[model samples]
Target chain A: EPEVTQTPSHQVTQMGQEVILRCVPISNHLYFYWYRQILGQKVEFLVSFYNNEISEKSEIFDDQFSVERPDGSNFTLKIRSTKLEDSAMYFCASSGGKPQHFGDGTRLSIL
Target chain B: TQLLEQSPQFLSIQEGENLTVYCNSSSVFSSLQWYRQEPGEGPVLLVTVVTGGEVKKLKRLTFQFGDARKDSSLHITAAQPGDTGLYLCAGIGRAGDNTDKLIFGTGTRLQVFP
Candidate 1:
C-alpha cells in the first residue's frame, strides 16, 4: 500500500535557526495535514492544506510557521525560528476522503 | 476547542487476554478514527467510524462508535505481543470547517506480554 513519506527522519538545529520538514504525501491524495507530538503528549494538530491554501491552523501554528506545496508532490513545513519548546515529533498526513494516512514522522530537536 | 479523552492510560496483559480501550468526548464529531503507534514511528490508521452506532471488525480487533457520535471503543480479543502499542483515537472536525484536522485523544498504551 502507498504511504506518506517524510525526509530527514531526525534533525538537530540550533535555537533561532530555521528548519524545514519535508513530506511527500500519497500521489493521489488531496488533503494534507501537519501535526506534532511533544514527548509523552497527545498529538496536536498544526495545520491543514487543500487546493494550495491553508484550510485551518491552530494557535501553535503561529507567525513562525508556514507550509508550502512547492511542487505537486512535496509538502514542507518551515519554522522561521526554532526554540527549545519546538522540539517534537512532526507528522505529515494525507487523505483522499476519510482515514488519513500518516508518515513515519520527523523528530526535530532544538539545541 | 474539542478534546478527546481516553481511559486506562496504560494496560498490561498476558498473552491470549482480552482488552478494551475507550475514547470519549463531550463534543460530537463527524467521524472518528483509531490508530496504533509503535515506538519511534507515527500513528498507523486502524479503522474509521463515520456513522453513529457503527461497528467495524478487523480480525481480532473490533471497533464501535457510540450512538451519539461522541465516543468510541476498541476491543482486542486474544491479544498477542504484536498488539502492544500506543492506541490513539481522533475525532475529525465538523463539516465546512477543517474537517481533515484530527483532534486526538490522550492515548492508551497497551503492553501485551507473551
Candidate 2:
C-alpha cells in the first residue's frame, strides 16, 4: 500500500536555527495536514493545506512556521527560528477522503 | 475548538483479555478515525467512521461511531501482546469543503500482556 514518507526521521537543531521537515504524501491524495506531539502530551493540529494553499491553521502555527508544496509529491514545514518549545514529533498526513494516512514522523529536537 | 477526550489513558491487561476505549466530544464531526501508534513512530490509520451510529469491525477490533457523531468507541476482543499500543481517535473537520483538519483525542495506552 502507498504510504506517506518523511525524511530525516530524526533531527537535532539548535535554538534560533532553521529546520525543515519534509514529507512525500501518498500519490493521488489531495489534502495534507501537519500535526505535532510533545512527549507525553496529546497531539496538536498545526495546519491544513489543499490546492496548494492553506485552508486553516492553529495558533501554534505562528509567523515562524510555513508550509509549502514545492513540488507535486513533496510537502514541507519550515520553522524560521527554532525554540526549545519547538521540540516534538512532527507528523504529516494525506488523504483523498475518509481515511487519512500519516507519515512515520520527524522527531525534531532543539537544543 | 473541538476537543476529543479519550478515557483510560493507560491500560495494561493480560493476553486474551477484552478491552474498550472511549472518545468523547461536545462538537459534532463529519467523520471520526481511529489510529494506533507504537513507540518512536507516527500514528497509523486503523479505521474511519463516516456515518452516525456506524459500526466497523477489523478482526478482533471493533469500532463504533455515536448516533450524534460526537463520540466513538473501540473494542478489542481477546487481545494479544501485539495489541499493546497507544490508541487515538481523531475527528475530521467539516468547516470547509476541502477541510483536512483533524482533532486528535487525548489517547489511550493499552498494554495487553502475554
Candidate 3:
C-alpha cells in the first residue's frame, strides 16, 4: 500500500531562523494537510490545501507559516522565524476522500 | 473552536482485559475517525465512522458513532500488549467534503502489561 513519506525525520534549528518540513503524500491523493503536536498536547491542525490553494487553516497557522505544493509530488511547510513554541512533531496527511492517511512526521526542535 | 475530549487520559491494564475509550464533543461532525499512535510517530488511521449511530467492528475492536454525530466510542475486547499506544479521535466539521481539517481529541494513552 502507498503511504505518505516525510523527510528529515528530525530537524533542529536555531530560534529566529527559517525551517522547512517536507512531505510526499500518496501519489493519487489530492487533499493535503499539515498538523502539529506539542509534547503532551493534542494534535492541532495547521492548514489544508486542495486544488493548488489553501482550503482551510487554523488560527495556529499564522502569517509566519506557509505551505506550498512546490511541485506535483512535494508538499512543504515553511516557518519564516522559528520560535521555541514551534518545536513539535509536524505531521503531513493526504486524502483522496473521507479518511486521511498520515506520514510518520517530522520532529522540529527549535533551539 | 471545536474540541474533542477523550476520557481517561491514561489507562493501564493487563493483557486480555477489555477497555473502552470515549470521545465527546458539543459540536457536530460529519465523520469521526479513530487513530492509534506510537510514541514519536504520527497517528495511524484505525477506523472511520461516517453515518450517525453507525457501528463497525474490526476483529476485537468495535467502534460506534453517536446518533447526533457529536460523540463516538471504541471498545476493545481482550486487548493485547500490541494494543498499547496512544489512541486519538478526530472529527471533520463538515459533511460530504474531504477538505476539512480534523479536530483531534486530547488523546488517551493506554499501557497494556503482558
Candidate 4:
C-alpha cells in the first residue's frame, strides 16, 4: 500500500541532549506532516511541509523544534534541547491530497 | 482553536453487537477522516468523507458526514474483537488548500469482546 515509514521506532535521550526523528513519506505524496501523541492525550499537530517549506505549524512546535527535508526521500524533525514533556509518540504522515497516511511512529523518551 | 469532541470516550460490547461513535466540532471542516489505532502504533486511516451529508460504507462499517460539515459519525454493525482499538476523527481546516493540517478528535476507545 506504500505507507509512510519512520526510523528508530524508539528513541531514548538525555533531557538536555538533541534528538532527531526520521521519516520517509510515500514516494509520490507531496504533503508531509508531523504529529505527536502524549500518553493518554489526543494527537497534536506539530508541522506540515510542502514545496520544500513549512506550510503550517502548531503552537506546540516551538523554538526547540525544527523540520527538514534534507534529501528527496528523508524528512527529519530535530529537537535542539529535549525536555521531559517532549516525550511522546511522534508520527509522520503524507498525502496525495485529502486523506493522509501515517507511519507506525517513533517513541521518544527523555531521561 | 479547533476542537473535535468525540462522545462516549470508551465502549465495550459483546461480539455481534452494533455500535456508533460520534465526532463533533463547532468549527466547520472541509473533510473528515476516521482512523483506527492499536497500541504502540500510529493511526491507520479507514475512511475520508468530503461532502456534507455524505455516507460511505465499508464492509460492516458505515460513515456519515454531517450536513453542516461540523460533525461525523461511524457505525459498526456486528462488530468483532478485531474491531477493538482507539478510533479517531480528524478534520482538515480548508477545502482546497493542499497544505492544511489535520485536527484530531479526542478519540473513542472501543473494546469488542469475543
DockQ score of the complex predicted as candidate 4: 0.86
Error of 4 at A51 (Å): 1.5
Q: On a 0 to 1 TM-score scale, where does candidate 4 land against the true structure?
A: 0.96
Per residue, candidate 4 scores C-alpha lDDT tens digits across A1-111 of 788999999999999999999999999999999999999999999999999999999899999999999989999999999999999999999989867889999999999
Per-residue lDDT of model 1, residues A45-71, tens digit only: 999999999998999999999999998
For model 4, what TM-score is found for chain B?
A: 0.93
User: What value does the interface RMSD of model 2 take?
Assistant: 1.0
Best of the two (1, 4) by DockQ: 1
Query: Model 3, B1-114: lDDT tens per residue?
Result: 437899889999999999999999987888899999998778999999989999999999999999999999999999999999999999986545554789899999999999
Between prediction 1 and prediction 2, the one with superior DockQ is 1
Error of 3 at B21 (Å): 0.4
How does residue A83 of candidate 3 score in lDDT?
Answer: 99
Cα lDDT tens digits, model 3, A2-109, are 999998999999999999999999999999999999988999999999999999998999999999999899999999999999999999999997678999999999
Clashing pairs in 3: none
Error of 2 at B54 (Å): 1.7
Error of 4 at A93 (Å): 0.6
Q: What is each predicted model's overall lDDT from 0 to 1?
A: 0.94, 0.92, 0.93, 0.93
